[model samples]
Target: MRDHTEFDSFAAFCDQSPWAFDDVADVRDVSRARLDEYVAGRTDFETWEEMKTRAAEEEIIDQIVS
Candidate 1:
């Protein structure tokens, strides 16, 4: 959850792994830049794809509950 951080005019969040998720729809565009950091023995998750899948599941559940 990159803080739902966004870049209206193309700003970089990091020197190497920069990314911005303006909306959930934009989540389709996976940010592999930051993925290596997580996959390098820092978390249970191995890839951004896994995080996205779990997030998508939660979103669906939230919609149903709402």
Candidate 2:
């Protein structure tokens, strides 16, 4: 896994990019909400596959929009 510093740097880079923030907020919000649901035992995906799939789809959409 990446260290916090590396993640921070990557986030900084994203913040600087024109492709960031605008759609990221919505995507992140949805992802967080879904994650919270899972954490609250409302779902049953022992792994992160579902979350990852949603994130990947969102990312693709973001890329297309950008």
lDDT of each: 0.49, 0.45
Tens digits of per-residue lDDT, candidate 2, 1-66, equal 022112244346345433335553544544555445542342233333563555578679889999
List ranges where model 1 is wrong by over 4 Å.
2-34, 39-44
Backbone clashes in model 1, listed as residue pairs: none
Worst 10 residues of 1 by lDDT: 7-16
User: How well does each candidate superpose onto the true structure, as a TM-score?
Assistant: 0.41, 0.32
Q: Candidate 1 on 1-66: residue-level lDDT in tens? A: 343323222123232233455654554566565554533343345676664576688789889999
Q: Residue 46 of candidate 1: its Cα lDDT?
A: 66
